[model samples]
Target: MYRLSGVVKRYRRGRATIDALAGVDLTIEDGDQLVIKGPTGGGKSTLLQMLGGLDRPTSGTVELDGTDLARLSEAKLTRVRAATVGFVFQNFNLIPTLNAQENVEAALVPLGTRAAERRRRAAEALESVGLAERRAHLPSELSGGQQQRVAIARALVKQPKVLLADEPTGNLDENMRDEIVGLLEKMWREHGLTYVVVTHDTAIARRASRVATIRKGHVKVAEN
Candidate 1:
């Protein structure tokens, strides 16, 4: 569902030009659980951002479901991201002012779904993430794990074709990490949610059907 061909990204830092991704050629098929592992300063997060349509490549092409993301207009890309992609961040990016239910509903606004339908889908998504009872709670009112689950629910509410998770378990404890991974696995298998998880955790990488190690802006290894 994702294809990156000769992808290049560079940033100017003082007199030096840093390449975030240097000719990255990668493909991720539909319904695959792929884990990306790398050290700090590697291009894992950069690649994720490109795939999420949050950033454009300096050169080359990024295609999502046959649509070349690099060629899309800003407005069109925004719609594509809202309708086809979901993102989970290391720090749960939930709105502090909005309750869990409202946070999920925010994603549906772009779809122009009716208020009643939005609430219903939001509640169902929260329930899927095991946060049904906490729908009315604010971010501060919930524990760290619950907050992350809310973020997951917000992402999943779109029923996105692909889910991009960057350091998804970075802020959670071991038990909570395990719980979150378990939930992800369940979603991947049950709903066929395609996932590209950016993580440094070997255990998380091992859980994926395929694992790719990025180093110095290149893919060093891919193990199936």
Candidate 2:
């Protein structure tokens, strides 16, 4: 479902150039659950951004379902991203002004879904994350886990084929982390969604079918 061939991303820092990703080559099949483990600034997030069409590669090829991302215009890429990827972040980037259901409904804007259908799907997504009762609550009214669940609901509302999660369990306590991880795995199985999760937490890393360790802009599979 996703492929990256010799993908590279470089950034200028002061007078030096830093390579975030150095010729990354990866393929993720449909329904695969993959984890990327790395220290801070190891390019795991950069790779996720590339996969989600949030950032363009400096030079190299990134393809989603066979369409080359490097060749796409920004508008075209945005459309592709809307249809293909869902993102869950550690910060749970929900709009403070909007309640849970409205936050999830925002994801449907690009898809041209009707308001009624959007609300219905948002409700269902929240239910999947065990947040159905909290739908009308604002982000500040909820616990950390509940806010994160709402973020997950927003991501899932679109029913994206690929779920790109960045440090998904970072802010929660151990019990909350476990709860979120369980819900994520359940959603993956029930929805047949492909996932690439970036995390520093060992427990979260253990849940993935495959784990790749990244360091110094390079990645390798860690032997069990």
Candidate 3:
């Protein structure tokens, strides 16, 4: 579902040129659970951005479901991301004011789904994340793990083909981390969703079908 061929991403730091990704060649198949592990500043987040159509590569190609993201117009890439991809962050990027249900429904607003249908789907999504009863709670009222669950619900409410998670377990305790990983595994199986998770946790990496480590600016497969 994802293919990156000789992908290079370079940026300027003052006058110095820095390469975030240097010739990264990687592929993520449909329904794959791929874990990307690396030290800080190794370009794992940049790679996820490339996969999600959030950033364009400086060179080479990033193809998602046969569509080359680098070749798309910004408007077209936005549409692709809205229609095909979902993202979860380590920080649980939920709005403080919006309740859990509203947060999930917000994702459907861009797709022009009817209000009633959006509500229904949002309820179902919350249920999937085991947050059905807490749908009315605000982010401030929830624990860190609960807030993360709300974020996951919001991400999955779109029914995206692929989910890009950047250090989803970074802000949680070990037990909460295990819970989140198990929840992701359940969702992947139920939705047949493709997952590319960028994390430094070895336990999370072990849960994936494939593991790749990024160092400096290169990608190395730990094992398949």
Tell me which of candidates 1 and 2 scores higher on TM-score: 1
Estimate TM-scores for all models.
0.98, 0.97, 0.98
For model 1, how does the per-residue alpha-carbon lDDT over 107-201 read when each residue is reduced to its tens digit? 99997889999999999999999889999999999998999899888888989988999999999999999999898778778778789999999
* Model 1 per-residue lDDT at 91: 94
- Cα lDDT tens digits, model 3, 156-214, are 98899999899998999999999999998888899999988999988888877799899
Q: How many clashes show up in model 3?
A: 0
Q: Each prediction's Cα lDDT score?
A: 0.91, 0.90, 0.92
Clash pairs (backbone) in predicted model 3: none
Better of 2 and 3 by TM-score: 3
User: What is the overall TM-score of model 2 with all chains considered together?
Assistant: 0.97
**Prediction 3 global C-alpha lDDT:** 0.92
Which 10 consecutive residues of model 1 have the lowest summed lDDT?
215-224
